[model samples]
Target: MERNAPVSRFGTVEVEDLPDDLRERLAPVVERSGFTPNIFRALGRRPAELRAFLDYHDALMTSDEGLSRAERELVVVATSGANGCPYCVVAHGAILRLRTKEPHLADLVATNPHGCELEPRQRAIVDLALRLALHPAGFGEADLRAARDAGLTDDEIWDVGSITAFFAASNRLAHLFGLRPNDEFFTMGR
Candidate 1:
């Protein structure tokens, strides 16, 4: 019987290749997640930027903020979908499914907002995130008002915008580098 070769999704980066602080901080995440996310390895091509990126990412994603984990992942998936970033769409979509425990929500949010069985507030949040992703220049007070009307506090609105903006940057980075999603992402929590 022939043994199947393990597929490699991430490029190798030596510990010395990474900045000291980044390697330190990322070690646990890499170990716990069982794989360093492609973004981590890709960003390792530039260690300083990688460190800054991880810092900002944690601040937004892991903060005690107004957005729930599901809400933050929702913004990431919706915005990444609009940006057409398969890496983020797949990665964050998996997070959304896991956090919300709604296996099909990612596809619904990615393909069409109307298809998702979201509360009115969640719908407004996703709508605002998509607008910010696709037409950031046109985003204005009206958009903010809609989010506010959805019962999102001002800080929560800012969190939504911040998450949207971060993923926009991430989408471009992934596109520029042709980052690929890990295969595990596809079936995770589904």
Candidate 2:
């Protein structure tokens, strides 16, 4: 399942070439993940944007909110799918499978929700994330009400929106830079 190596549309930035602060911050991630994601490298084309993006990303994805890690990954996969961002769908779908131990669930959510055997609450979360990703301008009170009715706490609902918004920005950036998913993402958790 290895894809072609990503050729940086924004050109490349070797980790050693990064500023000291970013290099330090990305060290643990590269050590844990075994590679620095192309997103980090692609965004590094603009150090300020990359730093800001990663800061917000860490805040949302590593929050104390009620949304479980798997649930947060779910929002990322679902919203990335809606955005047609292949990089995020593949990368976060791998994370979703690894976290949830449900290999089929990622494809189900990405390709078609009806195909996924999600619980009602899970379905509600995915629905909200997709809506936010696809139709943010149309989102309103009723959307929040539906999420609450689905038993999501206020914090979890906030997490869902925040994750969706973050990924919406991420999706565009990935596209803008022609960032590709790491080859390892394709085989993860399978």
Candidate 3:
């Protein structure tokens, strides 16, 4: 693999080199985002995994029923930043900025969500997500109960947990692969 850009510890598979199906899948993403997120490039080495990951990610994030897009991105930002996953913080931070229309919120939440002026519901959701992401062994049923008390629906709470779990895996993958945020992510939504 020869990376067209310096986006990962491992050489990345450039879009032109990708098999037709993978190229087709990633084209719109690059068009929409104006760059390839390093995760896609790194995972593109194995097209099947990239396809599966993207499908699952879309299914989880493209929802109208549960947590709003901003909230889901919040979970990723807070956990990923705390976990030191630079790619997720920068990439999802951009998404969070777009969704919330608060350009600085992702930076604030990622660095210190507890210090951010979150609504009671956002606070509860973030707290529960943090418990699961940063300290899973200590997570408990009471955490879910607290989220319920804060007015999260069962489905929304489920979204909180599932989104956190999904990004935990993504964060780990970024660490293992030394995935770097595409430079475009730094300025997006700002």
Best by lDDT: 2
By TM-score, the better pick of 1 and 2 is 2
The CA lDDT of each predicted structure is: 0.83, 0.88, 0.85
Q: Give me the runs in candidate 1 sitting further than 4 Å from their true place.
A: 1-17
Say which candidate scores most in TM-score. Answer: 2
Writing each residue's lDDT as its tens digit, candidate 2 over 1-190 gives: 2256554676878787999999999999899889988888887878898899988998999876589889999999999888888999999999999999998999989989545789998998999998888888999999999999999989998999999989998889878777778888889999
TM-score of each: 0.89, 0.94, 0.93
Tell me the tens digit of each residue's lDDT in model 3 across 1-190. Answer: 2225366777789888888988998899899877878898899888888888988898889888788888989888988977888889989999999999899889988888778898787799788888888889988888878988899999998898888898999999998887877778888899
- lDDT: worst 10-residue window of model 2: 1-10
- For every model shown, the clashing-pair count is 0, 0, 0
